[model samples]
Target: MSKKISYEFLEGIQLPITVKKDILEINKESERLLFINKIFQIF
Candidate 1:
């Protein structure tokens, strides 16, 4: 789903290793926040 699309999009970008890792870590944090928001919405 969206995960695959994001992975491919990241792969398509030609960035340095450190930058890529930082971007990925930020993305993971955002995704976690989104998940928490969804849980709050359901409550």
Candidate 2:
């Protein structure tokens, strides 16, 4: 999932460093939201 995406981005040498960092941050936020949603669903 996210790991695969991050790995692909890391391998993309043509992409700027700032863009890669931004993408990673976005991925983290999405993952965090998904985790929170799952917790709420359980309760």
Candidate number achieving the greatest TM-score relative to the actual structure: 1
TM-score for predicted model 2 compared with the true structure: 0.39
For each candidate, what is the lDDT? 0.55, 0.55
Off by over 4 Å in 1: 1-3, 27-43
lDDT of 2 by residue, 1-43 (tens): 4556455645754557775565556557557445434545986
Give TM-scores for every candidate, taking all chains together and pairing residue i with residue i.
Answer: 0.44, 0.39
Residue 37 deviation, candidate 2, in Å? 25
Residue 31, model 2: Cα distance from true site in angstroms = 8.7
After superposing all C-alphas onto the true structure, candidate 1 shows an RMSD in angstroms of 9.4
Runs of candidate 2 with Cα error greater than 4 angstroms are 28-43
Error of 1 at 1 (Å): 9.0
Tell how far residue 3 is off in model 2, in angstroms: 2.2
Across 1-43, the per-residue lDDT of candidate 1 in tens digits comes to 2355445555876757775565556456557446434545986
